[model samples]
Target: MEHKPLDQLRSVADVQPRPLSREERLQRWIDLLETDPKRRLSSLGEIEYKPPAERALLREDDSPLTVAYEDPVLRADGLSSDRLGDAMRYFALSDGQAHYALCSCLSGRTMEAGTCAQRLRNATGNVAWESAVGAWLLAALAVSLPGLVYLLS
Candidate 1:
């Protein structure tokens, strides 16, 4: 005689996975930030910085880092290489909108950069380090002419 198959198993309602502690989450963020840029960029959704319509197009040699350093507007705003590096590093660990903003800022796209700043501001909560980084980025952007205009309007 053929044996009957066992009944479908029911899922356990009480067997939920444990949530990550704050320390664990912070460690994870730090670990992600410490990873390579290509790897980190890939993990964070492979963001591409598109130039806005009103802005002059990017040159063939321009890259995110280069754009951050060489843009006259960004330079006029006093964005040093070190600060830009810090922003890039932080952006790599950040979510999509922040990445977009960082990329736009690097690309000299004022409107998109403003949008990115707003998104970053909305995201500040709970995590102290991330919030501090976000605040620094905001301060950096605020000094830029485009960013100042964005803030005004």
Candidate 2:
């Protein structure tokens, strides 16, 4: 094998694309999901106009389930793609909850109690009922905590 010239050498950083900012990653997910091409390109431009901090926070959510359900197509594409790992990390669900939610989302976008119970069993093996219930309860609490705190205070 011929050795590459110094001019032909490339750093690892150069070879590997820089990781996308949170805003761009979210926009990529939108690009994957949006059926309308114009709206997709338009969204890219819109995100650029946002302040960096606001754009960074566009995808942040206290509730994983809320993020998972925000857009059916985005969720479906994410669940099906390499972005599953990113989605899982961002959601911060426990392994059992992540698997169960992923399975349910893969099957359909809904995670209704009945379906969650059934999917949890199939996805999580033993003691799935409690895991599923706990996941639901935690997700509910995450969504409602601010309101509950305000109401109680």
For 16-103, candidate 1 gives per-residue lDDT tens digits of: 3355443343233333333333321211212343433212232222233343444443344443442333433433335343454344
Which digits, one per residue and each the tens of the lDDT, describe model 2 over residues 1-153?
777755556642244335455444444433333323222110111333456455333332212333334555544444332233445454333554545433423444333333433443344344666778999999999999999999999
Determine the backbone clash count of candidate 2: 0
Task: List per-prediction Cα lDDT, in the order shown.
Answer: 0.39, 0.43
The prediction achieving the highest lDDT against the true structure is: 2
CA deviation > 4 Å runs, candidate 2: 1-14, 36-86, 90-153
> Against the true structure, what is every candidate's RMSD?
18.5, 18.6
**TM-score, cand. 1 vs. native:** 0.22
Which residue pairs collide in model 1, if any? none
TM-score of each: 0.22, 0.24
